[model samples]
Target: MSDAWSHDEVIYPELGRILSESQGERNEEIAYALAICAGYAYAEVKGGADKVTLRKRLARVGLQDNTCKPIELSVDAMFIDSTAFVVRACEGKVAILCYRGTEIADLTDWLTDIDTEPETYSFPQAPDRRNWRVHSGFYRSTRATWDDVMAELASAGPEALYITGHSLGGAMAAMAGVMLRKDQDPRHRQVRDALKAVYTYGQPMIGNVEFARECQADPFLRDNVIRHVHRNDIVPHLPPVATGPFAHFGTEFRYLNDPPGLESPSGYWRRNASARQAGMIDFALTPWEFVARRIPMAGSLVARWRPIGAKIEAVADRVEKAADTLHVPFGRPPSFVCYSIEDHAPHHYIAKLATPGVLSEFERERTSVS
Candidate 1:
């Protein structure tokens, strides 16, 4: 088993399917369907994956993958697509549910609203953070697809559940982790009740301070939620900690080097090594630098509109400081700074988790529990 197995494979093999690239045809009936697995799946969705192909790749993993066919979640809501699959590997029955991330191509065409509007969400069953508010856009997108995924999982029999996603999809995966923990769906309450763990990559802050503390204290989340942030990728700091009160939720795993087993096939170690030798530009950027880089990414698409209090000056300081605080505690100095967008790519995560330092953290926890 190579180091790229980010999660403790003994406990979360299904998730391994999400991180590995497939190496063959979906119908090959032999080994991996492609060189890259879900990484290739990510490319299929600049619209969405061809259902036939996705199902085939999933089948190769010894599981059945199903979707809410017309999850047709309002395009207005970002929940572009959803899939539910059941793994009957040696680990017994484990179901995995995932959300497709923001279609960058989708966002490229539309203007984005960055305003922060704190709003309460109503759920029939009270969750740990009912007062919980979320990124309005993300929350809207989750509305339908969550129901669809939950409904499917509901019908699927009791099993340990593993929830995950990357990027915007990562944020939604976090929320589904929370929602599933609640008795929201009586039908699959057993499965939800058994949510084993939540693994999200490049996720953004989903709610305000109240929701953040709520999740921090929530028993289910305290032990299970793991957010992986690569050196300085920009999305994680978003919903701007300075703007209002939106805060990130979960325990963060930050890695400076690649995880032991999973080395980048292209030998990214050399690239990162070369970048670091030039003064290790991997550290966090200063307020001005952070904003300078961030602003350009938003480009002309993001409205300069701030909801009343989103003063550019005030928020800048808070976001910068918050980045330092959240990123500093877990790793050493070089791991702190984030220099490029490449840091946000799953390829990097796939590489980092393959290393022992970060990957071992997960292995240790699973070992302790088992």
Candidate 2:
């Protein structure tokens, strides 16, 4: 009923107990438990609820107010240490779940190969193009990555699967959710088919028109994929021009003013806010800047390593231009847009370019840059 509900108030202890028992394994319980906790934490920050209020609510669900603590959070991962219990739901049955954070030897396989051969790729160079096909290549690559990840999960035949990630990880999770919904692999199809949901926090836009349509049309993807974004976190504002499924993804933009300080309760909240804002900004500008400048040797390698005459440079130009054009229609610019005393000027970095009158120039820049 309110903007957001506290985890303790919202999560049922009896349900948690039942889920844990049914899951039958500590690792599975840990995974589902943390996801549920993460979802609650997201709600608290987004809603701007007081810490005391959230803590009191968590107590209702059998967790102590002091149990939750912030831990290391990485690009594609997060680690939270909390004493709170978790429940697992699988194949229409609740149990204590079993899970492993990762068993794959090279989890980095999904990422763009920028490390080993840094100078191979420059950003895609192209003309000013807003067509659907222009964006499909990036979408397809990410989609395929998730498909592969889900296929591996399907092999294990788990009860119910919950996927989550922050920022790029979130983007990856959304793609995984889409593929898991329609996965036909009969081996672990039961668990794949029983996917509980996906929760992506501060996830960027990952795909284009048809890709969005495919995600929205699938029953599992439509209801289970929950994406949360902080109001001024610009990374989520990427791959512009939504098809169908992504139309509403950016609408529920989460707003937080500052990082929670570690010294006090309020400080803790502010530190989280600050960290999220910083992380989002970094996610958007860092890699592209590196790629755009042709700095990473591996990147240049990937660019040149492409199929004969790959239009990598040309495509990158259009992506930059398109990002400039697609302004989110959220109700208002975030308070931090004006208040934050940051050296990097996010508000006006591409300001004039976003104006209707400047389209030709943005296009011109797109063409000549490549």
Candidate 3:
């Protein structure tokens, strides 16, 4: 809606409206969208590009450069350091924490190593304050990413604290929300209270049924977490309920490119969801198909930063093995394949959000004015 992005034909009406003006949480929503752009920035790093390229990539996506240098931080969690997890602020108010998705070089292998049956871990800052538990793997990964991100978020004192990612990053973003929401750090009570919204795309279930239930059972926490899942995207349903009882948290926004009634809901999708639809995803990925179609192309067109080569064959083997496991007892459920690799692309998400028709009435009005 700003003259800056007027040239973009597929304006994200809601996002466009937010960009044009400042009001209550308008900037907050805009900030969340910007976080997705930043998430892609981290994802590009997986291809082994340098920081200058990262800055250029951010600019290409319409993000203004940050004036403050100290706030640009990286994660050092148990899984990965720097690139895998990063917190960057754009346009001042929106403080975004981005978690990078999986990459071919150890990316597929790392995902394959994820514990099917995740244990529960208590918050290190809990006990004396509150008793909350999270997926063992997610909690450990969060600590490794940053033990005190909650602390930093509180100190920022922004109107909204936006946490986001795609694929694995999405799951981590949700986990980060859980940790911050239940944070017992007396000093961070403000940050915990300051959380306004959480957005994730193509993310998987970060916890089991218990985790989902706990989050849904609470009204305050429930409203703040929103998930944008492309219909039939299997990445959102992985670890298959067969291997684990993992379920998702947050309100679901299901969009399949012009599907009727997929508009913003007045309530949670889980409580109001209709029957499942047939999957358009093709789960049959041959070793060659993965290496040829999935791996190298995982990096978006914006950057050629890929970790490619002969090692990809090994990663492709893991992909086949993962496909096998996606089936029974320890693999994917019969319904899991309903979601496919094509639905998981981050660019598609950005494109979908930008579609003009998805805008609300107010968004449309703003578009006319702009």
Candidate 4:
């Protein structure tokens, strides 16, 4: 057994040797360790940031758009075979197309493979109602798009519709569900009532108060919408604000604490509220910062001009920073409370308000006809 083989796993003699010998493998190893350490120090870290560094990393890897223009592309191009996966997952079900701005080009593969016989179209373009002051381009356009998608779904048949996406895709899926409930067309009503579940990972908030409440109003929708958020993944908390009253409506929030065999980096990014405030100084300044600095300018487009980029950066940074602060779910009093997963109410209570019980159990007793 060599000194480097202390445990079952092989060990590098030194950092320099590992860097030179391992090459590309070293960076991933370091990142994994950093992710783990970060989890332990998460509470003490200011701003309660998650995925802050990861987002920056992704930006470095050329995964962002620097253009300040509204996104208009499809949802299939963002991930590996994302569109194909979406199609496989959503076959037969009438799908409501929702997504982050106009970055549809990223999703072209998915769109191209869609069965042309059952057509799909887009929502009218407009600004998002949630965070009204901010121009997210999710609200008006998505609302119109939902109406059209619903009409098509109704025509197809009264059956469940599948909603899917990552990041902006996820947010769009949430918005579509909201519109499904808000509208009252006879065809829409039938389709909405018979809707299938929405499963979106890393979704951002889409609408404001009215839309959220509408989504929450439907018990079916609320019960059916499941959102999965990675603990350190920052995309889900973007564009800031709960656009609607039930922004978290019909969306069962699932927290992925961390991957089992990963480590986080030490040294948290201090949550300097002052720095955050500075980031939001004005649109005239700091437009193209961080990820925003990288979008390829189309022709002589002023959208990609340096000055415009800086202004956008300032706003985006503030929104990102603000979102970081609100990561924890609202309403649970901060304290050291403990209980087993199997505990019930009263003597063995879980939270002050709840105990171990399934929604189905509650429903069964309530619906038992006397």
Candidate 5:
């Protein structure tokens, strides 16, 4: 185990208190805490920590009274590879299931992510079981662990359940949420009712339009599945809708990096254009800045010559203004072409959510809703 995970300080202070206080309601605090859990799921897999150790880590973060032990499940079968962990919080009043994201070194994970082939999706309660289509890889992965996940949920018997994951895991989390909610088994009714929300970060589209419509038609699924897309994160744009029957459903909360604020879907393109323009300007200025720093006398000379400096600044400003006028229409170049993979890192989501500004906005919105 790494020192970070082993440290005594609470990784997520007041998470238990927040979960208990919320009483299964979806709130910013719960979402923030779950993001931490999702990130920890990655750590748990990477560090190869056993359940006892994982429980200790969870306890350190304030999930102190988990009578139901944490359970980690790993599945590696014909094109289906995934790792996930389930644990109870607030004395089993809340259950959290976190799926591990794709590891760069794992070929199987990459294959699973890129497998865009569509497959027939049929659940007992699905409105049009025969016509529903979903990503083949994600479907298989969710199916592989469905029985085990349901069994754990039954054992935990939580009043509210939160499902979360990052990257590829996020995709599976969405699928699992749908499966659980659509399950017709009377034995799993408690599991379905206990599902408070599905939270995902940097997730990709998991199903076709028909499947998406199914999610939209269902009141609970429509309102509770929340997707967080970090600024210019590339993963969420995978398996392009133009290339396949893939589509994304549920509410989305997009966080912008530049100026650092939440953005609506309608404003995504404008924000992307601005961010891209800023990046371009920065790239253009870097060479000059580097040369000025490298040539010590050059910087002094530029400073001494006010006209030359003023002229340079004026030209740069003009360029920036001209760039601002150039609009990059949504889906013109395609998001994957311009997005940054680094923005999709799990830590970014964790850090962004914990930021005071973002939390304040979330809190204000929550308060308004209440």
Candidate 6:
């Protein structure tokens, strides 16, 4: 088992079927494809893959030449880098924007993730933008590449646009959706009119209650934004609403549970409580684990020392087992067990989306609603 951060290959095994069925609409199959695109965006950003390499990778997954293009954008502040891929599918009528999540080694990304202070949303086209407050870090990240993303969308000229991303990228995607929908600029009207849906995985809350209310008030956003929270992913519960004005708006789909399906706010809260507990435990052990892994024989000495040594050894054993379960740190993986840090990994999302009957069930529900 290798670290997901180092895994660069992006292959959608069901791409051909997904592309054939989705046509030009939003569906589970399309969502799955976009998730793959999101993962590929990470590869593009981290590996610094060239256009030829990106095209070749997309071609391997059945995308035709010129159907998809990678866009890399960065800001001077904290050297914040943002990467997305624009895919013109369904004979160029449907466009998908896929944003890359945070890289593990990037200090700037972690800083962006932790900067939860709310700031007034600044968008000239939005009439009530002054009243809207959003996560400062995410807002800066989205604004950094806003011009370039809009330029790509304008150039694509698609009839419908779908947005998707994982983790921090998901935050950016949500912000982009709001900004694009609010933009009344005539030059961007085509792109704005084309905005259809945003699908995010393991995304954290992006705004205040007022901001959420605005998103809910807009029929387009209310009907189109879909959030996917896979099991015990810890990201979605971030920037704690209890402590701040942070909030989320969108239809939430909870995956990888028994009778996997959607979850209401109350149900989500119940699950969140459990995840919070696990997160606390993980947090407490993080420093010790870090020291143990670095210093020579530290783990063994800690386990064999004194009266409390037995308890420490037992806890260490559990951590080892959890790490083995996902070949990563227990604090990280998205899991059905406890809240895991690794659960936020894109590979977990990719695997769950590729699971049999998951997308089919989601597609059935979507079609019935339509």
Q: Which candidate is the best by TM-score?
A: 5
lDDT of 1 at 17: 49
Worst 10 residues of 3 by lDDT: 266-275
Q: What is the C-alpha lDDT profile of model 2 across 36-95, one tens digit per residue?
A: 333343323432323443334344433332222221122332121111112223332431
TM-score of 5: 0.70
CA-only RMSD, every prediction: 12.4, 19.2, 10.9, 21.1, 10.9, 12.1
Please identify model 5 stretches exceeding 4 Å from their true place: 1-14, 20-26, 44-57, 67-77, 126-129, 258-337, 355-370
Over the full model, what C-alpha lDDT does candidate 4 score relative to the true structure?
A: 0.34
TM-scores, one per candidate: 0.59, 0.38, 0.62, 0.37, 0.70, 0.67
User: At residue 286, what lDDT does model 1 achieve?
Assistant: 32
Better of 1 and 2 by lDDT: 1
Residues 244-336 of candidate 3: C-alpha lDDT, one tens digit per residue: 566677776755434357543322222213112222232343222334444555534211322232134335445655775785334222332
Which candidate gets the maximum lDDT versus the true structure? 5
Clashes of 4: 46
Clash pairs (backbone) in predicted model 5: none
Worst 10 residues of 6 by lDDT: 268-277
Q: Write down the lDDT that model 5 would get.
A: 0.66
lDDT of 6 by residue, 16-84 (tens): 446544433446556665666666666643467345554554554445543766667665475466777
Tens-digit per-residue lDDT, 282-349, candidate 4: 21122223223254553234233534543454465566656659783333221111111111111111
Model 1 per-residue lDDT tens digits across residues 111-151? 22243465476544445435667666556555656666666
- Which ranges in model 4 have alpha carbons more than 4 Å from their true place? 1-136, 209-214, 241-247, 258-370
- TM-score ranking, best first: 5, 6, 3, 1, 2, 4
Question: Mind giving the per-residue lDDT tens digits that candidate 5 earns over 95-210?
Answer: 88878778777777788887878878785675444668899888888887778878888987888788899998899999998988888889899888878789888888888877
Error of 3 at 149 (Å): 3.1
The segments of candidate 3 whose C-alpha lies over 4 angstroms from its true place after superposition are 1-32, 43-92, 123-134, 151-155, 259-337, 355-370
| Winner on lDDT (4 vs 5) | 5
Positional deviation of 42 in candidate 5, in angstroms? Answer: 1.7
